[model samples]
Target: VKRFVHISVTNPDIDSPFAYFKGKAIMEQTLIGSGLSYAIIRPTLIFGKEDILINNIAWILKRFPVYAVFGDGEYRVQPVYAGDLAKLAVELSKTSENIICDAVGPETYTFRRLVTLIKNRVGSSAKIVNTNPKMAFLISKILNLLVRDVVVTREEIYGLMADTIVSNEKPRCSTSFSNWLEKNADLLGTNYVSELNRHFKKINEDAGYRISG
Candidate 1:
C-alpha cells in the first residue's frame, strides 16, 4: 500500500476558532478516514531560505526603527528547518505505518527573545515596543495597504499569543535556529516576498503585479 504524507500544524482541532487550525484538523480527519497508510507531519514554525514569517520580521526590522511586540511577548515558538522537515517527510513516505509526529527544532524561544535575536542577527537598530493586540493588528492592516500584501492577520496574532505554534513533543529536527540565522542574516530580508504575487500572479510579472479580486 502506498503511504500518504500530510503536513499539518502543531495543534489542530476541529473546534478551533481560527480557520488555519480548524482547516488543518478537518483535513487530517479526512485523510485519516480515507483508509490509507498515512503519516501526519505537524510542524510548528518552519523557517528556511524562503520562509515568510521570519523573513518578514527581518524585513520590518531592517526598514522600521521601531518594532511592535503584541502583548508581553512571552509566547514561545519552536521553529523547524525546512530541509529537516522535507527529510522527515521523505523518510516517513517510505514507511507503511500510520504515524503522527511533531517536526520541531531543538531550541524554543520566547517571542520577545526570538525577535531580539533576529534584530541582532540582521544588525538592526530598531526599538522593540510592547503594544496591545488591537494596536498591532491595526498597524499590520495599514502596512497591508501600503505594501499591497497581507502583512499579517488577526488570526495569526491570536495563534501566536495563544502559543499554538510550539510543540511539547520530543524534538525531531536537528537544525538550530540561531545557527541558521547567523549564516543567512545577510540574505534574510533584503527583499520583501509577497505571498499574493507568488501565488496569484505569474512569476515573471512580479515587478508590476497588481492585486485583483
Candidate 2:
C-alpha cells in the first residue's frame, strides 16, 4: 500500500483562537479516522527558496524605508527549510506505521533576531524600529494603500504579536534559515507577489495575472 502522508501545522487544537488552526485540527481528526496507516508531519514556520513569509519580509524590506517590530520582539521561531521538510516527507511516506511528528529546524531565533538576520543577509536598507502593535497596524495599512498590495494582513499582525511560531521539542531538520537566506540572497526579493495571484488569477495562459513561486 502506498503510505499516506499528511502535512499540518504544529498546533491545531480546538482551543486555538485562530479559525485556521482549529480547522487544521479538524482536518487531522478526519485523516486519523480514515483508518489508513499514515504519517503526519507538522512544521513550524517553514522557510526556503522564495517562501511566503520569509520572502515577503524581504519584499517589504526591499521596497520600504522602514520595518516595524511589534513590542520588544522577543518571540521565538523555529524555521524548517522546505527542502529538508520535503525529504522528511518522502522518508515518512516510505514507512508503513502511523506516525506524527514536528518538523522544525535545529536553531531558534527571536523575532528581533529573525528580522535582523533577514536584513543583514539580504542587505536591506530599511530602518528597523520597534513600535506598538496598534501603530504597526496603522503603518502597514498606510503602506498597503501606497503600494497597492496587501502589505501586511491584520491576521499576520496578530500572529506576529502573539509570537506563537516556535516549537518546544527538538527539531528534526538540519537546514538553517540564516544560511539559506545567505545562499539565496540573489533571488529572494526579485519581486513582490501576492498569494492570491500565485494560487489563482492565472488559471489560463492569458486569463489574468501571471503567477510565480
Candidate 3:
C-alpha cells in the first residue's frame, strides 16, 4: 500500500510456487496494516507477446506439436493482456482509490480451448492430448527434487484449475483475448518458437547438458 498501485495475485494460505495465493494474501495483509493509500489488482494469467512464462508455455506447446493436458483441460480462466494490466497499474498509481480490482481479459476459456487458440494463432501443427493429474504430479515431483523448480507442482496446478475467475469489482479497462491475439499474432507464431529454442539452449547449457553420476 505504501505509495499506491499495489497489484498482486490472489495467493493461497499455504506456501508453494503456487505460493502466489499465499504471497498475495501477505501483501493484502501488509496493505491493510500499513494504513497507506493504495489500489490492489489481482490479474489472472496475464499474457503478452514477450511474456516469459505463460507465453513461453504457449510457444513451447506450439513447437512440440504435442501437449499434455493435465486434469481434463476443463479449467476456465480469463487471460489478461500484460499491456492492459500495465495500464491499470499506472492508472492506479496516479488515481486515488482504496480498492482491489481483478484485471482479466474479456473472454473466459478452458485450458484445452486456450491451447486451440494458441494453435490457431501460431498455426502450429500441435495436438493437445488429455492427461491425468497423477502424471503431472510425478513430473512435478521429479522437477522439484532434481531442479528445485516448483513451477509445476500440485498446488500450482490447483490454482490453474480450481481458482475462481478474478473479480473486477472496482472496474477497469478490459481487453479481449481475441484482440490481444490479433495484435500480436506474429509474435505468438514462429518468432516466439524460435526465441524459445534459443532460450531452451541456454537453459540446457546452464543446467549442464547432462548430469553425470
Candidate 4:
C-alpha cells in the first residue's frame, strides 16, 4: 500500500504570508478526492539546523534589531523541529492509510519570544517592536510597488495569527525546541559559506558537469 503523507501548516488560506500554502491546501483537497490511502501532517513553525525561515529570520533580527512585529507580539506558535517531523513522517509512511495529523512543539511561544531567541543567538542587541496590520499592509504595498516584490503584507499578518498549536492529539514524536537548539547549537549562527563551497566542489567532480560562469 502506498501512503501519501503531506506536511502542511495551519493556514492554507489565500490570505497567507506565502502563496504556496494555498497551493498545498489545493493539493490536499485533490488527494482526498483521489481515493488513495494518505496522511496529511500540518506542522507548526519548524526550527532546526539548516532551517531556512526560522533560522534565517533569527539571524537577521539578531544582527538587525529594527524589525517590527505584525501585532502586539501576543500571537502564539508551536515551533517544531525538522528532525522530529521527519521521524513522524517516516513512521507514517510505513502505514497505508489516510490520516490528518498536526505536528507541533511541546511549548507555545509568542512571536516576540521567537525573535528574542534569535537576538540572543546573533549577539545583536536588537529590539522588537509591534505594528498594526493595516500599517504593515500599507508599508508592504508601497515597498512591493517600488521593489517589484511583496515582502510583507496584511494578509500575511492575518495568516500568522492562525497559530499552529497542535490540538489535543497525541504527536507521533515530541522534540522540544530547547532540545533541538541544544543539539544543533553549533549550527545556530554559523555562516555556512564553506558548506556551499563544498557542495559546488562535489557537483564539479560529477561527470559532464561544468561551471560555465
Candidate 5:
C-alpha cells in the first residue's frame, strides 16, 4: 500500500507490563518500519452501537451485585465513538504524512467512574468494588464461566490498570460517551454478545473467504 492508516492504542509502550500495550507497540513499530507514508490513529476506549467494551460493561452492571475495578481504579479512560474512529481513519487515508494522531473523545472518565457510569445508565444497584490485580483476574475468569461469555479478559484487566488513556492532542471525535449512552440506553445490553462470535460471523459472511478458526 502507498499509504497506511494504522489503528492502535494511545501511547503503547513496548516495555509496559501489560502484553496488550506491548503488542500495540510492536504493531506500531512494524508499521513504521514498512516504509509507507503512514498515520497511526490511537484511540482509547471506543464506544458505539453494539460495541464490545461499553455493552459488556452494561451486561455486568445489569447482572452482578458488585462490579470489580482493577486496583485503585484511578486510571483515566478517554473513549472515542466508533463512528469518530472510522471518520478519522478515512481522513488519514488521504494524507501522505507520517504522523500519529489520537482519536479520543471529548470526555475523560476514571476507571471507577466509567464503571459507575455504566451502572447508573443501566439503572443497576450494583456496588463498585476495588479488587487487587491478581484477584481481579481470577474473578474475571469465574465470571466468564458463570455467564458463559467473556465478562472480562486478563489482558483487558491489565490494560485498564494503566495510569491513563487520555490524550493532550485535539480529539478527532466529538461524540460524548455520556450522551451516546443516553441515546442508546435501551439497547446497550440486551444479551450476551461474544467478541469471537462477532469476529467469526463477519469472516464467515464474507463473499469469497472462509475462516476456520
Candidate 6:
C-alpha cells in the first residue's frame, strides 16, 4: 500500500488503565513501526447518525426525569463530525508523509454544557444533577442491567474527567457539532442503540449457527 490511514482516539496511552485507550495506543505504535507511510487520525468524540454517546445521552434525557453529571462535569470535549473525520482520512491517504494529527471539530464544550445543550435541543425537562463519580458509576451499572446494554464504563468516566479528549491543536474538521445537532435533534435518541447486540451478540449467534451446521 502506498499509504495507510488509521483511526485512533485522542491522547491514547499504552499505560492507560482503560482497554479502549490502551488498545488504540498499542495499535498506533504497531502501525508506526511497520515502515509504512502512515497517517494517524486521532479524533475525540465523533458524532453522526450511528453514534453511541450523544445519541444515548439524548435517549437517557428523553426517558429519565433526572440526569446525572459525574464530578464537576467541567472537563471539555471536542467532537468531530464523522463525515469530516472520514474526509480527513481519505485526504491523508494520498500523502506520502508519515503524519499524526488531531481530528477535532470546530467547537468545544464542557461536559455539563454539552449535556445541557442536548437537553435543551431535545426539549427534555430532566433535571441535571451533579453527583460523585462513584455514585454515577453505580447508577450506570444499574442502568446497564435494566437496559441490558452497557450504559457507561468507569474508564470512560475517568477519561472524560481527565479531559483527554480535547486537544490544543487547531481544529482539523469544519463541521460544527452544535449546528448539526440543531438539524438532527428531532431524530436523535428516538431509539436506543445496543453495543452488545450490534457487535458481540451477532458474532456469537453466527458462531453458534456455524457450529450447529
> Which is the leading candidate under TM-score?
6
User: Model 6: residues >4 Å from true position, as ranges?
Assistant: 209-213
Name the better of 3 and 4 by TM-score: 3
Model 5 TM-score (2 dp): 0.88
Q: Tens digits of per-residue lDDT for model 1 on 1-213?
A: 578899999999999989999999999999999999999999999999989889989999999999999999999999899999999999999988999899999999999999999999999999999999999999999889877898888999998999999998999999999999999999988988887766777754666755652
Per model, state how many residue pairs clash. Answer: 0, 0, 7, 0, 0, 0
Residue pairs in candidate 4 whose N, alpha carbon or C atoms collide under 3 angstroms? none
Model 3 Cα lDDT, one tens digit per residue, 133-196: 7887775566445433343657657777774545444435577887777677677534332333
Residue 143, model 6, lDDT: 91
**Cα-based RMSD of the predictions, in order?**
2.8, 2.7, 5.6, 6.0, 3.3, 2.8
RMSD over all Cα atoms, model 3: 5.6
**In candidate 5, where is summed lDDT lowest over 10 consecutive residues?**
204-213
Worst 10 residues of 1 by lDDT: 204-213
Question: Ten residues in a row with the worst lDDT in model 4?
Answer: 190-199
- Candidate 5 — number of clashing residue pairs? 0
How do the residues 1-213 of candidate 6 rate in per-residue lDDT, one tens digit apiece? 878899999999999888898999999999999998899999999999899889999999999999999999899999999999999999999889999999999899999999999999999999999999999999999998877888888988988998889989999999999999999999998988877776677677877842111
Look at candidate 3 and tell me the lDDT of residue 203.
Answer: 81
Q: What does the lDDT read for residue 167 in candidate 6?
A: 89
Q: lDDT tens string, model 5, 1-213?
A: 799888888879999888877888999999999888999989888888878878878888888789888999988888899998998899889977899988899998888998898888889899999999899888888877765556677777776776547888887799999999888988877776777657665766676665332
Prediction 3 TM-score vs. true: 0.74
The count of residue-pair clashes in candidate 1 stands at 0
Question: Which lDDT value does model 6 have at 67?
Answer: 99
| 3 Cα displacement, candidate 1 (Å) | 1.5
Among all windows of 10 consecutive residues in model 6, the one with the lowest summed lDDT is 204-213
Q: Which residue runs of candidate 4 sit more than 4 Å off their true CA positions?
A: 11-21, 134-154, 164-168, 182-186, 189-213
| Candidate 2 TM-score versus the reference | 0.88
Better of 2 and 6 by lDDT: 6
